[model samples]
Target chain A: MKPIQLQLKQISYSYNGEKQVLKNVNLDISQGEKIAILGANGAGKSTLFTCMNGVITPDSGEIVIEGKKITKKNKIELTKKVAFVFQQPDNQIIAPTVLSEISFGAMNLKLPQEQVLKRVYEAMEYMNLKTFENRTTHTLSGGEKKRVTIADSIVMQPHIYLFDEPTTALDPLHQQMLEEVLEKLSQQGKTILLSTHDVDFAYRFAQRVIVFYKGEIIADDTAETVFCNNKVLSMSNLKQPILLQIQHILMQKGLLKQCNIFAKNIQQFQKLI
Target chain B: MEKHFEQIDYFAYHSPFRKYSAMSKFIFTMTLLLLCLYFNNIAISCYIIVTMLLINVLKNNIKLYDYIVMLSIPFVFVFFGCIAIAIEIHFENHIIIYVTKQTVLKSICVMARTFGAVSILYFFTLSTPIYQMVFVFQKLHIPKILTELMYITYRYLFILIEIQHQIKIAAISRLGYCDIKTSLKTFSSCIANLFILSLKKAQKHYQAMEARCYTGELLFLQEKQYYNKTTTIKATLYILSILLLKIVLRGQAL
Candidate 1:
């Protein structure tokens, strides 16, 4: 069995203790696992992500990263292991230029300046943001800012990367760009967990799906199985991924019998056609 | 408001001085300003204003008319502020206003100084981006809180402006501002909503920083550049000439 990279035991949190945002949630993430966290607005997805990234300490829970308990003292060290890319690139990007933005996380790790530069360079190359290194961050378009922010996190070279709704405001081209980066990182054996409301994105990209409904994990399973569960979808206030619905409709009409193909994404759908 | 943003963007990104190191430009600005203040000489002050205008028109390629128009906006405000200094008021049987030679001369000196200072600032700001100016602040050993606050403020200023603009658009779209009374209500509500939204945005920004391993100590990428010795030397010589003019050419009654 693979070693657990991250473990959350009976984790719970509430904003100002007014209402329970997270209610006794438990999750175990393994090495190199790709998870898609889906939930409606106010479902505590952001809060849960904060706990996973060590930003928000759970009120009553234990988070163990690679067998070491996450505490305030070691949270800084844990940051080196878990890199979080916030949803709004404008908020997360503090640097004036792209190069500086990418170097920030690595510099925080107390890495040598040269090593920091090296990491930033490689991250820019990975994200194809090398050309924008000299440009001011605010001058960039929305998609470009998203890439720079992603590169900013990638510089840390963390074992586990958390992205909060990265694809939400991105245009189609930039969304495809993000997908390529994620695929490349996944190939590099990095554990990637992203929170998003786009069920189709999760269906096409994530291997495992975790559905959060009012701060509780209502369903967790492989992508195909989770999407096929109508009860889980309704309970979690999530709809089936568009591709799945298309596949189901085609199957019912006996149109896909010739190809026997149920596609997961546009490419798979094209291949089937 | 959108036009204003576009204009600022023009100066920030497209100014010819954007390429020069901010430290050099800032140093020159400081030197010129100090000389103008220390000597309080009319010629040197006039020289400052002229040089600023020349830089904007010739070096930065800004239209002469545009520079004058922008300068005029502040010119009126400063003019009113300096009116008290310019006029000697005597209240006997009736209100009297007189620009006596001494009083007029005093106000002229003050005007020259004010205009000199404003021009030097424009020279620095029109050329150098705000981020680079912040870098210069970092080099000056300014407080982290000050610079970080400045950086965050600079970052959020545009976002807030954008939010206000969007709210205005939405209000107009929904006929929320169709009438004068409704317009007042809509405007007031927009301002109120902006406060709440801005607070939420600030919180999110802090959380994002934390996620990036920020441990309260703010970090930035410093642009690597060596001081242009020639420019520094020329600027030093220029300041010395101005000082020499103040001392050598003084006592010439106008």
Candidate 2:
């Protein structure tokens, strides 16, 4: 079995001592796991991510990365291993130019200059941002800016990647590109976690799904199991993926066999049909 | 109007002068600005203004009309400012306003000096990108706090402008600016809302930065900018010619 990459122990957080945002949350993320967090707005998904990334220290529990407990003294070191891509590219981008923006995190690591530039260029090539090196960050289109922010995190070469609503403002084409980027990261043996409202995307992309509802984890299991749980879906106010809905209807009509595993994407569905 | 603001940055990225070192440009502009003021002569001031404007337009490919429109923003302020210097006011029971020959000439000199200084600064900004200027400032040993403030302020200006644009659109769609009274009320409300929104955005931005491991310093790789000997030589010759022109035109009246 893969070793646990990150473990959260009864973590809870609140803003300004008001309205507990995350309550007694516990999670064990294995290495190279592709997990999608499904939640409504203000469901504590973002708060959980920030807590894991060391941006917000949990009010009550503890977070351990690679068996190393994160504390105030070593928080920076532990945080360097986790990259959090913000939902808004504008807020994440600190530098004016694309080259500097992507290199901001890598440079912060105090790495050699050559290594920093090499990582930046490699990430840019991977993200197809070679031509946009010197372009002003604000002048970029919404999709392009999103890619830059992803590249910014990629340059850090973190072990775990957390994306907060990565597809919120992306168009279909850009969304496809982001899926490819996520696939590449997963293939590189990095743990990936993203919070999203797109159930269809989560259905096709994530191997595991975690549902957050009102500062509590309602469901955490394989995508097939979580989506098949009607209670979890209703509690989170999330609808089942369209493909899963079709599969269920077919099974109810006695046209399809009930199986433990089901097709999660269009290609698999077509083959099954 | 937003297009005009964006065009300044667009041209800076594409301008031929972008290849030159920002430090060199800064020094050159500052020297010319000081000389323009110290000489305080009309011919020298006009010479500085015309040359800077011509170079920006001809080399940078900026449209003459657009450049004038941008410059007119400062021209309005300078014009009104010159009026105060041009006229003399006297109070004897009632107020009396009069213009003397000396005051008129003095106001023209002040106007010339202001235009010369402004044009030289424009040449620098129209060619060098803001980040490059910030890099130069860092190299000059500016306080880290000041540099950080400068950079964030420059970046947030665009974000704030974009938010303002969206808010204005929403207001227009709701008929919030239909009449004078309504427009005044809407404008005040917009300002109030903008302040709150900006604060929220600032906090979010700081959080985002912290997530990336920002401790105290804003660090990034500065690309090496090499100075070209030819550009330096040309800049030097330009300064010499301006000084010679000032000396020869000291007593001349325009």
Candidate 3:
């Protein structure tokens, strides 16, 4: 089996004193796992991602990365292992210029000037932001800003990438581009963990799905199993993709026996039919 | 044609000025301010203003109207000072006439000097980036604590503006513009809400900063290439000539 990349054992946390946001959460992610965190609003998905990235310290239990227990002393080191792409691109972008913003994280690593420039260029190129290296970040469109934030994290080359609702406000085209980027990253053996309410994107991209409801992991299984289970889907405030729903309707009408619910594009949908 | 002029306005050229060293610009403006205090001659102040106007026109290609509007900000203080002194004079304060003349001239001179100072400072800021400015401050051995505060304040200014915009939208959605009294209450509540939102955002930003391995020190990447030597020399000579003219004009007045 692949080496375990991250393991969260009985992790519990709370923003306020009385109410616990996450309780008894146990998850073990191995290398190259593409996991989608599914939840409704106030389901504590953000808190869980924040805890995983060490932005929030758990009240109890342990977080282990590569067999080493994460503590206050090694939190900085863990940052190198896990990179977080925040929900809003504006919050993460500190530099005035695109080039500087992309290079901001690399500068923290204390790398040499040449190395920093090289990595910045590579990241910008990877995100197709090379043309905008000199542009003011504030002047960029929403999709451009999103791509830059992703590029900023990818430049660090972390083993595990955490995306907090990466495609929340993006248009369909931008969302597709993000999905493609995530697919590429997953193919390169990068452990991808993203929390999103976009069930269609999740079904199309994620190999495994974990559902959260009322601050607890309600279900953790493959995409097909999770989408087909009506009970868990209803409780989590989630529905299958539109095509999947249509396919189910056809089956109920005695038009089809079963359907492949993970069709990502029109071509795939055609083949499925 | 108006669009063209607007494009070439003073604020338009501020982008390049933001790249300059803030410490150098700050010291330069402060020195000019001190000199204006020591020399209370209108001729010298006028000379300085003219020089700044010429620089703005020639180097930055700023329009005359834009330049005048920017230069007029300091005169607001002079206008208020003159009014205060006029009021005192009407109260039959004869013994204070000489003092009032001196004060009035000094205020005018201060305003003129401020115009030049603001122009130069604006040029510096419009040309330089904030990171470069912070780096310059750090290299000057300024206290890291103060520089860090400046950095945070600068970053949060935009964030606060965004929050304010959102609050404005929410207020308007709740029919905040229907009447004056209710509008005031809405405005006050919006302001309060903005403060709370800003505080929460600041906390989240702080956590995010720490997650990115921000260890107290605000680090910036140095420019790979040095500034062009010839351009620096030419700009220095241009500024020195203006200084020389101001000194000569003041000496003639004395």
Candidate 4:
């Protein structure tokens, strides 16, 4: 097996100490795994990602990336390994101009000037943000800002990419584009971990799904298995993807023979029908 | 409450004097202000005002009407100052005493000088971006902490204005404007909420900065090539000659 890129062992956290946000969470993400964290609102999905990225420290237990324990001593070095894209694009974007925003993370690393520009241009090209290099960040549309945030993170070239609800507020076309970008990144052997409420997005993009419920992992399995589990689905407050819902209905009616939920292409679904 | 005013972009134009360094502009404006204060001659002060207007026209491309309105802002003070001086003179009840030529001329001179100093500063602001001005301050060895605070304050001024607009709309929606008493209460609460929200935002922004590995030091990465030596020299020479001519011509009157 490939070495584990990220690990959280018996981790727990509380915002105010009166109420715990995450409890006894043990998660291990291998190299290049496309994992999706799913949960209802206030389920601590965001809190978990924050802990993983070292944005928030757990009240107890340990978060280890690779083999080193994450502590204040190595937090800055650890950040270079885990890049986080915040849920709100507006909050994450601090620079006035697009090129400067993209270069922000790289520049923070104190990289050489030429290397910073090179990575910025490459990230811009990768995120298809070359056109808006000189544009003011405030003037860009929601999708454009989202892309800029992604470009900002990707410029760091971190080993593990953590996105908190990356698809939120994006139009359908942009959502599809985001999924494609994530897929391409996963294929390049980057460990992509994203939190989302959208079950369909997780089904399409994530290979493994971890369901969070009121600060605990309720289910951790392959996407197909997790979605097929009614208990996990209800606990997570997640509906099955539309295709899966249609598949189940057809299966019940004997219109389809098998209840196989994993279908990547429309032709496969059509053939199944 | 129209946020989008017609003259919104009035300050966007780079002031011709802005091309010079902030230190140079500061020195020039302060010297001109001192000269205006020292001389109690209406003719000399008027000459300075005319020179300022001509510079504004040639450098900033300001319209004739806009320049006139800009110059008129201080006349209210001039009016009050002249009236006060006249009243002081009228205590003896002499007809000529209340309206002495010297008193009138002195008030007009004071007003012209005040207007001249304001116009020069206005031109300075019009030409320089607020960020660049802050950078100039930093380069002048001003405390980094103070400069950073000023920079953030300047950038967020527009953002806070937008927030105030939203807060007003929210207040109006809650029937805040239905009565004068309620309106006053709503306005006070809005002000309180604005401060609270700004503080919260500042905290969040600080956290975001920490997340991005921001230390206390502010890092600027403008290319060294952006500062053209020849252009700066030419701009300096142009501003100096005009300033020299104004001082030379005005000194001749003394």
Instruction: Highest TM-score: give the candidate number.
Output: 2
What tens digits encode model 1's per-residue C-alpha lDDT throughout A154-262? 8988899889998978989999989989999989999999999888889888989999999999989999899999999988778998888887888789887645345
Q: Looking at model 1 chain A, which ten-residue stretch has the lowest summed lDDT?
A: A256-265
Task: Point out where model 1 deviates above 4 Å.
Answer: A257-262, A270-273, B1-6, B240-248
| Total backbone collisions for each predicted model | 0, 0, 18, 3
Per-residue lDDT of model 3, residues B1-254, tens digit only: 32332233324325443444445555555566555545655666566667667765776566778667655665677667655654443346444433566666555565655565565555555455555566678778889998777767656665676677777887888899679998899989988988888777777766666657677666655543344556566656755765676667754643
* Candidates 1 and 4, the one with greater DockQ: 1
**Interface RMS deviation of candidate 3:** 2.3
Against the native complex, each candidate's DockQ, computed on alpha carbons, is 0.64, 0.73, 0.40, 0.29
Fraction of true interface contacts that also occur in model 2: 0.69
Residue runs of model 2 more than 4 Å from their true location after superposition: B1-4, B89-98, B223-226, B250-254
Q: Model 2, A1-273: lDDT tens per residue?
A: 899989999999999999999999999999999999998899999999999999999999989999999888899866799999999998888788899888889888889999999999999999999999888888899999999999988998999999999999899999999999999999999999999999999999999999999899999999999999999998888999999999989989988888766899989988777
Q: Which number leads on lDDT?
A: 2
- What lDDT does model 3 reach? 0.75
Order by lDDT, highest first: 2, 1, 3, 4
Better of 2 and 4 by lDDT: 2
List model 4 lDDT by residue over A1-273, tens digit each: 889888889999998787999989999889999899999999998888777767677899887888988887787766788888888776676665577678777888899999989998899999998888756565578899899989888888989998999989999999989989998998899999999988888887888999999999999999989988999898777998877888888888888887554574466688776
Which interface RMSD values do the candidates have, in the order shown? 1.4, 1.0, 2.3, 2.7
Which residues of candidate 4, in runs, are more than 4 Å off?
A: A130-140, A259-261, A264-273, B1-99, B223-237, B240-244, B247-254
* RMSD of each candidate relative to the true structure: 2.4, 2.0, 4.0, 4.1
TM-score against native, each model: 0.93, 0.95, 0.88, 0.83
lDDT of 3 by residue, A225-271 (tens): 89889999999889987767777787789876664555655678777
lDDT of 4: 0.75
